[model samples]
Target: MSFDYDLFVIGGGSGGVRAARVAAQAGARVALAEESRYGGTCVIRGCVPKKLMVFASEYPGAMADAQAYGWTVHAGGFDWSAFHGKLEAELDRLEGVYRGILSGNNVTTFDARATLADAHTIELSTGERLSARHVLVAAGGHPVRPDIPGAELGIVSDDIFKLDALPRSILIVGGGYIACEFACILNGLGVQVTQYYRGAQILRGFDGEARGLVADEMIRSGVDLHLGTNVLGMARAEGGVRVTPTHGEEKVFGAVMFATGRVPNTAGMGLEAAGVELGRNGEIVVDDYSQSTVPSIYAIGDVTDRVNLTPVAIREGMAFVETVIKGNPTPVDHALIPTAIFTQPEMGTVGLSEEEARDQEPVEVYAASFKPMQQSFAGRDDRVLMKLIVSRETRKVLGCHIVAPGAGEMIQLAGIAVKMGATKEDFDHTVAVHPTMSEEIVTMSAPVRTG
Candidate 1:
């Protein structure tokens, strides 16, 4: 069939942009449309800005630690205006880079929302209708505030980057990674941060011991964390925002932010009319190959709700291009993904949790909790944890979880070994790096508990 393009990509997110570029590079005609910024969530309002905030928030402690090291380091208060300005500039540059990549790849771009006009046609908000041989929906997701009275008074994670000034005190709601990370980030940035989670503990899906240490550390680090507590309502008061909780009386805070949850961005996109099956959360339903019920259409990224991380979305995009454009079949792999949480004390984890591993097989748990040399030497009471979950029958490391300052960096290397199916013996065979926290991974000889 004669079509205007071989691929019409909706939502110029990391996934959509990648698919469009790869398809075009493979000698296929490609067009992409995005209603918002080119760099999408991760670059524009998510991981990039959040990481910068994490870095900015760490300077105070770094300065204090420096002083303990006998280095005279003078410090000034965090200037929100300055840091936010730089963050905006960096986002602008990144967005430009994304645009440049698409243009350089000879992919047509439209700065307008694109919705499915049919199985193989896209209707742009600009009153343009284009037909393609295949359509790729890579629309991402957005954070949602919980349903409650005066919930509008509370901001989501997106609104954090937009605040002109950081509030003196914030009542944060939710206990997921976003909530925990922001709880840590705002606390470090010198905000009087109080977090409420209805659950019994924070970081629900992570290893129990690891999350336990995180919660304990968060409490010790001066976070007013209230687990098994939830906000009933919110209202504006003379002070700031008045919050009513299930467990406590009304309290006032400078702001109320909801890191409660996120939903896929799939509404009003004409996806239903075009025969694309959507999941319970309005997420597009796709198979292992990312192909929607409609053969001509495919979905990726958070829009599919299949591993919502940015890198996973990019990989899904690559797989889509390889399968559809390059005549190579590739199914998106969503297993054993290593993830890092940017909490006050960072967390990095991969594979199954000890609880999860034990549920499937007999396992040995090896764990250590101690104050690291650097922070201990600085007289900071902060402690770090290293844990390994090994399959008793196979002697393979089923899981590796680390809660330390650089756990994110440590996890990436550990992830490589775990991905390669490294056994507990394989780790023991490696030489330990002296005086390093990570050496604990290799130095632990005996299983602390074999079940």
Candidate 2:
């Protein structure tokens, strides 16, 4: 109605909503705009819903383990339609909670898409112009569809959540985390899964050993991995799709999924009209403090292409509010941000990888791979892989990498110490809690750090 707020936030995703609510709580008049659901990508389509499906897909594997634990699964079935319905229902519930949280904090919510009119003003698609002292853009990201003859025949990550039924067979394209996670999920659920990644290894940025272990594990789970491969085209076939590979043979499957990567949702936002600077990748260019080239405008989250994780965006939003609104200067440190892979035998790592750490300084790598003690009794073949990268001279633990069950939970605590510059001796001297998988971090006998 009026262009009089202290702060106007565009894109009510994880970052936008957080900034709006916090700024409003500090007595700033804040208005937030979202064209879609309130919870943004993570809560609606990206993280929450995807993770629920990952958990659901793990049940088939868990049932196999049940026999080892003296439990019988006489008869079982996976109802794809039921699972899809439940996921959608849960997302709807979360979207409402997100809206309530913002509203409860006195942040006004507008159900409209916003386009920049100028540095200090935005005009919604409905012709409502809103002006404010500061504007924060957190529109999030969208999956990319690589240009191919029959690209339209395949599905992107976003469409998978809306599928009415899971396919009996799936051919996944791309080698990034999304593709790998989906491969594991579908394969574990008893789908014939095939992954086509362009790189020689699936996760090119991770350590060679870690990537190798992940590939091994995926193969063990019956995933057909095609590395250093390219998808040439796709075509509708009899009851399925025919996918042609660039350097290989053609394959047919019931479904084709492309998990290439995500790009910023900055297009059509009228950013050019306001002279906002964008990077070559179409990401909003922001300074260390999250301020855009136009000082009055700011950007955060996947929109900026700087560490696309949801938590990183939340912290960046808070940093911007504290520094710009509250007069408390806070600069976010991007280093050592922990990330996790939800695939079977998940990966969790903080700080540098062994390769990256070695590049900066002389390093020693301490690693362990062992079948879990539970497996010794249950007769399960799962194993855990852990690694610690330390400076050869200083003996400071620079990185921690893990591939195992509960790796995500375990690395979070270790991330704090690593962030604080913990040394190898610190991990060694700390008394470990015995008879727990977690204690392995502190109690591993004989220092593995090498000179």
Candidate 3:
């Protein structure tokens, strides 16, 4: 049957926007609706603003390093208002760009929320009903506060970007990257930061050695990190948030932020009503091609709870376009993704963790941890780590993990090699670029440990 549009996309995040734009460009009539800002989490609240804060938070340490380098640098207090003003402006510009992209692609845009009226129809918040031949759900996810007394007193990751002023002290709860990263960011910004993780170690799924180093560095850098600890309850006190932990005495802080976990944003979207399958976590269940149980309905990105990274979402969107519009039947690849956690020391990892590698097959680990020249000369006690996990029988590099400054940038390049299935000999054959932290990746000749 003919419909009003070939595709109606619910959500304007990176994935939805890209899918809508690409499909429209392929000559399919398209429409996209967003309840909030256009750029979605990554650009509007998640990565972009957080990274800017990461940069803003590093100035104090940069000033100290500047002095060590014989430059006369006078560091001043952080002006959150000024930095936040500029941040908002940049976000506004980005949102406009996203809008421009949709408009330029000839896709109809709606500023209101959209939900499924049926498998082939969408109902917008504005009482407008539209039908489409295919429906794409990319509604994304949201950070949720834990179920505890006075939980409302605490804020989530999104609330971090909206604070009018930085807290003098914050008790950040959670051991995930978001919790650890913000703890480091606030500490760097001259705030008294205390982090509590219920788990034995932070970054639970990452390489044990890498996360251990990060936890140690965070403590060394003045973050009051308490492992195997959790907040039992909270109360609004005269000064700030009075927190009672599972193992510690009650204490007060200017704020308490919870990075406990995130859940799919699928509430009231009528997925179940339309016969779309959802996971226990409210995530839309989808096939490899991002097609939901309903043939005409599909989901991608965080909504599908598959590789929730922004780049992954964008890739899924592209794959969706290729499969649906281009008739290429492309499947989204969710393997060997390289990721960078912007903690104090930073971590970049790709492929299996050492623990995972050892569990699956016999492996050799080549590792080195030493003070880098720049940080050493600056009189900093900071040390960098480079490690490779290689399959013993296959001689293939199973994983590469780096912990140091610029690990993010280094991992991006390293990821390419690992993605190509580079072997130990392949890495060994490459000449080392001396006086570089990453050269260690190529120059490590012997296994520190083999299993």
- For each candidate, give its TM-score against the true structure: 0.99, 0.97, 0.99
lDDT, candidate 3, 1-451, per-residue tens? 8899999998999999999999999999999999999999999989999999999988888888889999999767899999999999999999999999999999999999998988998999999999999999999999999999999999999999899999999999999999999999999998999999999999999999999999999999999999999988999898999999999789999999999999999999999999999999999999999999999999999999978899999999999999998899999998899999999899999999999999999999999999999889899999889999999999999999999988999999999999999999999999999879999999998999999
- What would you estimate as the lDDT of candidate 3? 0.94
lDDT of 2 by residue, 110-200 (tens): 9999989898998988888879989999999999889998998999988888888788899999988899988998887778999998988
Pairs in clash, predicted candidate 2: none
Instruction: Give Cα-based local distance difference scores for all models.
Output: 0.93, 0.87, 0.94
Best by lDDT: 3
Q: Please give the TM-score that candidate 1 achieves against the real structure.
A: 0.99
**Pairs with steric clashes in candidate 1:** none
Tell me the TM-score of model 2. 0.97
**Candidate 3 Cα errors over 4 Å, as ranges:** none
Name the runs in model 1 displaced over 4 angstroms.
none
Off by over 4 Å in 2: 1-3, 445-451
- Model 2, backbone clash pairs (residues 3+ apart or across chains), number: 0
